[model samples]
Target: MACRCSPLLLPLLGWSALLLAPMLLVQFANAAIFVDDRGVQHTWDESTKARVAVRAGIGAVSLYHMGMREEQLAATWGLWGVRGSDFDPENPSQGSIYPEADPSPEEAAFLASAVNLSPSCWKNPRGCFQWDDTAEVLGMRDEIDFIVNIDNGSAEDSYNAAEEAGMNVIFIDTFYEYNENCRASNYSIIDTSFCYGRSMIDVAQRIEELAVFLGVEVDQNSLNQQKQAACDAAQAFTETMKDLHDKGIRVKVSIVDTELRDDTGVTTASVADFDPIELWVPRTLEELGMPLLHAASYENNEYGYIYSDEYFPDCTPGFVNDTCNGNTYFPVDFWLIDSRSFILIDDNFKLIFPDRAMLAGQYWSYPRNDGSISYVMIESLLNEYRTRLGSAVKLQDSTGTCTPADPKATAHLVADGTGGLGLNEFICYDEAAIQQEYLQCPTVAPVPPVSTPTSPTPPTANPPVPTSPNTSASSDAIMVSTITSIAAAAVTAFLMFCSTSG
Candidate 1:
C-alpha cells in the first residue's frame, strides 16, 4: 500500500524498524526490553547492529533529500556542476567521492552484495551506486538477510551454492529495471528517480518496500514525516522561484544538444525572453551526437580528448577540484562549443551552499565582458544584480518553449537607472548602452562627470586618468550598452550518473 503522509512532518524521526512480532509489540508498549545490570536480559545480537545503521540511515536519507531540494533550486540557471556547486550527499557523483560515504555500513551489510561493476562505468558507478566498493569489500556481502541479487555467471554459481545451503534465492534486477524511468524523472510508485535526489514519496515507498522484504514495519509517524518534508521542500522551492519572479530575474530555459542539429554548435530559438546560447555537452560518440555526458563516458581516457589538460589536468582528480583551482573543470572538449545556452524554466531557481559550504575556501571569480569583476556563481550574480539594479534582473514574461510561449521569444529586459527596467523587443540587445549605464550605476556609488570642468590651469585641473576603464578612449560619452557580451566558446554544463553492481 502507498504510504500516507501528514502535512506537519519535519524534525524527522530516527528509529529502527519495529519488529512485527506480537510479543515484541507488547514489550515495546510495556517498556519491558531494558535492564539495569539486574537479572533482566538485553537484546544483543549481530543483527541488532542493523538497528544502529537504521538510525544513521535516517540521517543519511534526510541529507540526501535536502541535497535533492538544493539541486532543484540550482538547476534554475543550469549551474549544476559549476559556479559553487554541491553534489547530492546520497548519490556521490558530483565532485569528490572520496570523503562522502552515504549508505551506513549497517545498511550496506543488511541486504546486498557488490560485484564488479559494468566495464563502461569505471567498474565504479557514480550517480548510480547505493554503496561504494569499499563497503562491499569490508564484509557487507557476508550478512544478507534474504532476497539477494543474481547474475548469469560466477555470481549465479555462488547464488546456487548459497541456495543449496538453504538460503532462499530471490531474483531482482533493480538497476536496469528502474534506470530509464529514474533518469527521466517520472516519479511514481513503480519507477522512481534514484540517486540524484530521491523524493520524499519515493523514499517512503522505498522504505515500505524494504520493510516488506525484511518482514518489518516502519513507524507511521516516521513515514509521514518523510512525506511532509517533501511537500514542505516543494513549497519552499516554489516560493523561491516566485520571489525571483517578482524581483524579475527569472530566465527561461530550453535545453538542447547543440552539436546534434548543427556543427556550429549554436542554434537559437531567436527568442529574447532568455539570451539562450548553444550549450556544450561532452559525449562518448561524436557520431551518436548525444550531449549528456555520463560518468561512463569519462572512463578509458576518452573524455580527455574533448576537455584540455589545462582545464581538467591529470593532476586534478575530481571533475571539479577547487583545492587545485577555483575553476570548474570538464574535458577540454567543452571549450569548443560555440555558445553557452539555457532556457530559463522558472524564476523559482536558486543557488545554494550545501553543508560543505563552510569547507569551501574559494569559488571562481573573474571579470566578464560586462566590465565587472565578480564571482561567476549564480547566487553571487543574482545578489550583485539585486544590489545594483534595486530589483533582480528578470526575464520578459514567457509562457513556454515555442517562440511565442518561450522565454526567448520575449523582449530582453533592460533596467533604466530611475528605479525601473523594461523589456526591449525592438532592439536585439544594446550591450554598449548597458555598459554605459553601469558607469552611472546609482546603486554602485554615483555617476562621474562626462568631463571634469576643463580646469583654467593645467596643475589644478587634475586631468582624468586614461587608465580608468569607466572612461572611453575615442569619445567622452557616458552612455551604457544594452548589448549582450561575448559568451565563452562553450558551457561547462554536465549531468552525472552512477550505477550499482548488478
Candidate 2:
C-alpha cells in the first residue's frame, strides 16, 4: 500500500532519513549472529558487547575473564591491589586496596577504565552471589551487553533473566567441575597445578572462543606463544629445583598464614586453619627433592589441629589442655627449630617467627584466593627457594640469637623486603658469600613495594628499566572520544526527530 506524506513534511522526512542513515548503518554493521561454546546461538549488538559482567564461582575465573579482554570494559567483582589494614575494622566496605589509601597513577587509570561492582555487592545481602537483584543492584541488567556466567550455582536465575532480557550470555563450564589435576588430590585447597596449569589453559581457550563469538580478531599466534613460554618456564623451574635436591642441598620450607593468629598464634580461622603443606607446597617440594619439615616431624594427620600429648610431649598440663582444645598457638617454634626457612602469607608473623626461622619470602601479599594465581606466581616461588637455598647461613650460635649482627642478613632482608622480619633474624649471603654465579643475593636495587601484584609479569631475561606512559593524557583522550560519540548521536537524533514531525 502506498502511503503519502503531507507536502510540507516530505522534505522533513527526507532530512530525517538522511540523519538516521549513518547511525543505522553503524548499528547494522555491529550486529552479528554467532554460537557460543555451549552450542547456543546468539545475536549480538555492538552497543551491548561494550559492557561485560563476569559471574564466576571462583575468583580466579573472574580475573581470567578481565585479563583475557582486549578492549571491552569489565565490571570488577572482587578486591584487587595491596595488603595491610586499608579498610576500617568496623566498616569493611570503606576501604581502599592501595597503600596510604591512594592508588598509584597506573592503578588509578586502570580503575577508572573498569566498572567496580565490589562496592555495590558489599552492601547486598548475599554479596556478589546475590541473583534476584543482581541485575538491578549491580546496575548491569540494562547497562551490560553480555553476562559471562560460569555456573557458580547461585547465578542460574540471573543468567536466565539476562537471556530473557535480550542480553547475550556467554556461558562457560555449565557443570563447573574442577579439572582432574585439581580434584585428584584430597587437599583442602585446589592443587596449584590446576590453579596455574589447567585452569589458565581453559581460560585461554575460552578467551579465543569468545573473540570468535564477538567477531573480534585476536593475535592467536601471540597468545599461543605466551602460553607456551609460561609452560616452559614452569617446567624449567621444577626441573632446576629437582636438580638442586639431587645435589644433597636440602631446602626445608613451610607455608604459613600468620594473620590467623590472635594473641595465641595460628588460630583455626579462615586460611590459617588449613595446612598448605598438605596441598601443593609439600607435593611440589617433595617433587623438587626438598624435605617437608612440618610433615616429617608432626605425626598427627591433621597438621593444624594439634591434639593429644603424643604430638607435644614437653608441654605443661595446662598447655597440653589448651593444645587439645585448639586454643594453643601453632607450634611455630618447634617447626622452625629444625626448618631454617619459611614463607608467610600474612605480615603478622614478623615478630613471632623472626627469632625462630628465617623469612624466605611472603606470598599473596594481596589476597591469594582472590584470583591471584598465575604462571609468574609459580616462577616467584621457585625463585624464592633458589635464593634461600643458595644464600642461607647460620647466624645463630648455640644460644639461638643473632650475635655480631651479620651484614648479609641486613642486606638480604632489605633487598627482598616484603614486610620481612627485622635484620636481626638470620644470616644470608653477601656478595662474597654467594658462591653460585647465578645467585644475585644482596641486590642493590630498591625492592618492589608491598603493593606489587602477586603474579606480576616476569621480567625479560635482560629486562630494560621500564618507563611509565602518560596515563593521564591517555585517559583524557578516551573520555573525549566517548563524549564526542554520545554528543554526536544525541544531536543527530534530535535533529532527525524535529525534522520528521508534522
Q: What is the lDDT of every predicted structure here?
A: 0.23, 0.38
Please state the error at residue 220 of candidate 2 in Å: 4.0
Segments in model 2 whose C-alpha atoms lie over 4 Å from true places: 1-50, 55-71, 82-108, 120-139, 150-168, 171-199, 215-217, 221-225, 247-314, 317-367, 372-502
User: TM-scores of the models, in the given order?
Assistant: 0.26, 0.42
lDDT of 1 by residue, 1-502 (tens): 3323322321121111112233343433333222211112233222221221111122223222222111111001011121111333233333432112123333222212223222222222211111222233233234443322311111344344544564433332211123333322112223222212211233223334433333333344544444443334333333443444344332221221212125333221121121211111111011111111121122322212222123323323222233433231221011111111221211211111110111221111211111101111112333322232233233223222211121111121111111101221111122222112112212222346798677585475676675656543222221111011111111111111111112
Q: How many residue pairs clash in each candidate?
A: 47, 1
After superposing candidate 1 on the true structure, give the runs of residues whose Cα lies further than 4 Å from its correct spot.
Answer: 1-143, 147-200, 245-502
On the 0 to 100 scale, the lDDT of residue 431 in model 2 is 25
Q: What is the per-residue lDDT of model 2 for residues 417-462, given as tens digits with 9 covering 90 to 100?
A: 1211221132221224321211212223344578856776887899
Instruction: Output the worst ten-in-a-row residue range by lDDT, candidate 2.
Output: 333-342
